[model samples]
Target chain A: MKEEIQDNLIQIHDLRISIYSEGSYFDVVKGLSLSVCSNEILCLVGESGCGKSITALSVMGLLPTDVAQVTNGEILFRGQDLLKLSASDMRRLRSDEISMIFQDPITSLDPVFTIGSLLTEIIRVHRNVGSSEAENMAVDALEAAQLPNARQRLKSYPHELSGGMRQRVMIALATALNPAVLIADEPTTALDVTVQAQILERLRERQREQKMGMLLITHDLAVVAEVADRVAVMYAGEIVEEASVQTLFDKPQHPYTQGLLGAIPDITARRGSLHAIPGRVPPPQVPPPGCEFAPRCVHALEECWESRPLLEGSGEGKLRCFNPQPLIT
Target chain B: MLIVLLISSVAVFYAIRLSGGDATAAALPGSATEEFREEFRARIGLDKPIYLQYFAYMGKILKGDPGHSITNNASLVEMLKEHGKNSLVLGGAAFALVFLIGVPLGVLASLRRNSWADHGIMSFSIAGMAIPNFWLALLAIWLFASTFRILPAAGCCSGKQLILPAIVLAFEGIALTVRMTRSAMIENQNNDFVRTLRAGGLSEWRVMGKHVLRNAMIPIISLAGLRIGQIVGYALIVEQIFSWPGIGQALVTAVLRRDYPVAQFFSLVLVVLVVLGNWLADTGYTLANPRLRRSR
Candidate 1:
């Protein structure tokens, strides 16, 4: 119990989530484990349909009840299993203990409400504050997100602001309370590159100032290189490699990570040809029997096709591969 | 708005042509001779060019006089003052019923989606829309007034007298409102903002009440204007069937008698009501979504 205090701010332990559709159920998120500790940024990098977004939603206890369910495992937040918590308790824990900012700012806000009401309502909901205090908090949050005209922008509706401005508003709303853990699901993906950099910088700065644990989910390797303290490379709904960012970038241990790194454009690559993995991610209904990435791996051996390999390594780094891809550096 | 009304008057001007000739002369009593008709026409300046006659009519309207009715020689303003009051009250009550029942039923039907509650409310609205208001008015009279000996069958003098007709008028409006509200809610249900609201740690009730309803309001309000137009149109038929003596019933009588001044006056008032109704709906959307106001 004493050791658990230093364990994690939010830890996902063997979490498995399944989606039900048209008389069949498929596990969108296989048995997975990860954690983000205080003052750290953990990047979860995965392509679309690999269950990155669903995993984020499950942490907030907001998965659509009719379509998806947590079949097994638990999400431990501050040592309490979030899966077993009451709905009312989860409601209170959210926005106060953990908050989330989503990808598309255009449709992520209630278009009918002004920013003032949207931000202040959350403050009033969690704290016994007067309207003036709530207003002050909202203005402070807007300014913290590095937005201009914070006072006037409070009265602007979602549609009145530009996409970048709206994303900033979302950041302000999510971070006003300074929660222990912040889940940002591709928050900068919908913005142009210039705005993207500014948004991420603000996010990193806020994380540093507040020392909040951040689970930043994105498939942009560039983003991973820029802000990740640690990186978990996901393929086919499973984490294939986990390590400190420097180690993962310099000495990727799994073939899938190697393929991803190789796929990045390089000046040395010859014309009309690029190095990319040959196959697509297998459909959930037809996943490979063993290692999920085996079909696309160049290092696949006989036993790699026969059984799923458990994640193995020291606490500092890990890899799940039967035939490893050694570093060239 | 005044220009729009003036343009709409061209349609009304054509309507007079469809009635054959000067409705003023044709509307004279059978006992009156040609001498009286000519004198009456000249007195109203009907011998002038068409544009002059139109200007004369417009000028008359501006002076707070709606002219004399050819039906009973009653002042057009006085007849409308009495009968229009009845129609206005009935229209207001029916409009209230449109939202009071329609909005709630719509919200529930949408929230429940394909459940039994959704099916039930939808089927009820379909039946409401399918059943003719005149037929329903007769049935309401038979059941609530004639058979049960409870509510009065006709007239707008008493509160009880209005029940049968008001219900008949509101039935279709409720149906229309339900369909609009349901479709709007369903459209907004998949919106990403709704998901964002839920992730804010807000309760389910607040999300649905504040967010879903607000996003769904623009369509609901726009449909309400269309519903008001249909209600006014149906009120004409419903008033006749129930012998309610409302403005719509009197307008029908005026049209049938080809009472030119009175018919034109009724058409003008109705057009105003519709324009005003649409204006109110637009105002509602702006108030509901502040983005529209900022753009304005």
Candidate 2:
């Protein structure tokens, strides 16, 4: 158990992020904690505006400093606190130790730069290699990402390629340096259904081959079911429930998690009306008292409205609910 | 471009003719008799109808003969060659000053955005846009030439004399370029690509200079081209103020004296240069952005 805990490449401890707007600051990610281990995929599932992307940005130290801030937290990467590291030191660690791919591939790459230049520059930034060597490495990365005509594609600009191809290039760039951890924030969201599978496959292949701890952020439960080793369900800036993929799917403990599982469109059942949670995720600035999901949860108890529950668990999973739903079967 | 020059020349010719000025009278002495004026007008081909005179002028221009000034009989081509050199020099110096100073300063201001430096640059740009160039030219002469006695007050014989007028001409251009560069860069800085670059651990300088600035330069290049055209118009007034012997001064003198051939040729040249500047800007826009190139 100790060895497994120690094997985590990145462990975020009680990270609280705040966003400034108009006049005052609002707590967005309220004391969230999660960990990513080598040879595993941890999917952080949440709807839009639930602070998932900002959390990923905070991990990369790429948050917009003027608007968002990490008020309290410790992001420990391999035992060193990332938040305490100097800007230069943090920069040295980025892409070399941990890298990221954004949601929209079309706008994520510089339109003016050729694929070869963009890839080669990144390789050269961290390595003391000549241009030719960097180019060779870039070609290799492109090939690994299953891009056809990898060498020829080097001369291509971002707009010249299809959305799927660009996402593959993004995957190539993020994994080229063989970082220990990769944060893919809805990487395939902008892609078509057919292209999404291919991108996910390539991403999984890279993550497994490199033994990289990948933190995949997405709102799609089908994606979570397909790619996640562990699943963490976030509601209103808090992780309501987290478990192994099988455990989370088979027996979702928290009421919010149960509602999410029920909301997935079922093909077998005769469809009369789709299942939907009653209410929406509360705004960060005006979250309801006690459990943030109380208004939306169907099985909320009286105690759930008085005080928030801490994330408590042992070996199999964690649940932050005073009134957890009964286990099925 | 050639079509634009032709249309512009025709318009200038008719407009100048309809202004009710007799070129023959301007060319002749005040004591000349009506019969002598009639002979002078007939000698210069002004006795023909307006459209016929335009056709003759256009035919002569097509054959590379700009004709002679009605006032002095000096070849219009020769006057153009001599004075065009000075305008070219002044315009080039002004453009050089605009880009060399505006781009870097704009980059710095954007990188340090919302800081005192950015505020200062923006405030200076507003002031630059508000102040009149001719008034600024006079003040510059007063400060640098009359008061400090460091630079020459007027004329274009020495390189030192080019400084005051060039600065005056480039002031608004620099201000506009700075504003454009800053806003363009700031907009590009917010793009998803910049975040990708930063996440990839590229240095801030690399992210900003190589990617952001390059993207921002597309619009800035077009602005630069438009500014070049505007500088010609500004040069007219700036030249009159500084007494610098440029084509602008020549055009004004020709207009006042009703030197038809000289004025018509200079107006055509100005139109051609402005159109050519826009063409260059369009070409530069395509070159700077690969997306545009691929689309074509």
Candidate 3:
């Protein structure tokens, strides 16, 4: 890890999210915290059903209140607690200081509206501009996102474009206002592998150019390796490790983090029989009493089964484990 | 679409024949001799074979003759034209009222979701659907005309008279529209685009009115064709109850008088209009839903 400014752009502190049904509440995200500094990409890596997407949704204030709610925690952006703000006030801050793009572009853009309308409307909402001026700004944003023939694509609806092109349009819409934070919830997961690389590269380029703090959520280890400046590994509902990407991958300490790295196929050496972590993520409704990932960890200790580990350590990274192990490398 | 119209014409011809009454005999006055009636039937081509009679009916419609009335022997064209205008005005007003109330209420219900406002709107629409139109018409008349003495109980005149009939005409339609709009809006509120729009910083109103409602319109517009057929059918029934003198009223009178040509012509025209409406709805559907347009 290099010595950097460390000026955090967005901070989630002790956040807990829960889903409610039939008069009973089940917590899905339990007391988790992480940060993204300006000009950095923080990849939230986890297996499916690990509450990664819900955490990202909470940050953007997009959680459906009837289904899920942020029961605890503060999402601090620009020194303001987002959860405490009124809905209207939060809306004004959205797409201006914070924006989001989703995993599937096809379903994320309004099918009845043109790309031009979708993009320009967002700009007009945040800024006082005439339609023509907004249109020009939208065009420039699309061009900045590396969409070819950007001006003409404006009239096209979402379905008229290919998946890659639509994703590019989504990137264009999200970044057009130059928000301080961008929460991308697996933006390229629905795209082709080739398009995935291109989209990730484009996002990195945008993050660098805008000096934006990006919270990139993904389950793919390769994506985390390619794009993350920092990595946070979540299991069940809690973040188990937070560190600079190099340290998390090269000197992983937590057993779950080690398992994730091991699970990644070795493309270079062409290893046969891929490795997998034992057991699946426990359903959030009935999370284990002690360490949530203890059942899946190969090096679990008796202490790990008796009590949960708090996120500890400093400097290069932090690990939440009673018995943190050093990698052989 | 054209094939549907042609088939509809054949159905109309047989429907009139199988109606269990002799139209030509009904057309003749009681004082006429049996010889004169026979001569009149032969002159009008009614004495021809069944297929020939079908061809003759089609020919009359194509020639724009419209045949004649059974009771008064008046020109069917002029009567239809007048009645058509009245029904159009009444139907258009009812259509506008249904949308005006249904859309905003549905949106409010969906946005409020499980709130009192949501329950109120849903319960009101259900009640509207449960009550029959004739019963509603009678109740509205009693309330507005008899109890309040502010409007007429029967007959079409004044904007006030138009109100009760239109309300009766719009009741089920309004109920349908509200339910459709509510379900579609609720479905769309959970849609990806709506989430994207909301996350993009647009105001809640803008998201609901623009993004959610806009996508929901595809189904609503598709419903228009079926609605128009229903609206027209509803208007006819409503008109008879109110003595509104609309086309539906005229058709009812013609049917009772055994005015076969007049009745058949009106049904055929209605069929054509419905088919045309459905065809137009396809275009409307394409406009509202861009995905269908792109696939072509």
Per-candidate fnat, comma-separated:
0.70, 0.89, 0.90
By lDDT, the best candidate is 2
- Candidate 2 structure quality by residue, lDDT tens digits, A214-261: 999999999999999999888888888889999999988988888778
Over A59-83, each residue of candidate 3 has an lDDT whose tens digit, in order, gives: 8888888799999989888668989
* CAPRI quality band, candidate 3: high
Ranking by lDDT: 2, 3, 1
Tens digits of per-residue lDDT, candidate 3, B1-296, equal 98999998999888887887766667887888888987887876778987899988788778988787767877889888888888888888888888888888888888888999999999999998999898898888889888999988877667877888988898888888999998998898888888889888998889988888988888988887777777887877899999998888888888888887778888887787778878888888887888888785
* Span of 10 residues, lowest total lDDT, candidate 1 chain A: A1-10
- lDDT (CA) per prediction: 0.87, 0.91, 0.87
TM-score of chain B of each: 0.92, 0.97, 0.95
TM for every model, in the order presented, reads: 0.95, 0.97, 0.95
Which lDDT tens digits does candidate 1 get at residues A1-329? 66757758888888899899989999999988988899989999988889898999999998998999999998999889999999989998888889999999999998888889999988888889999999999999999998899999888888888889999999998999989899999999999999999999999999999999999999999999999999998877788889999999999989888888877877875686787889889999777898898887778898888899988886679899988968653
lDDT of 3 at B198: 86
Reference-based lDDT, residue A197, model 1: 97
> What would the DockQ be for model 1?
0.71
Query: Positional deviation of A322 in candidate 3, in angstroms?
Result: 1.4
- List of chain A TM-scores, every candidate: 0.97, 0.98, 0.96
Every candidate's DockQ is 0.71, 0.87, 0.84
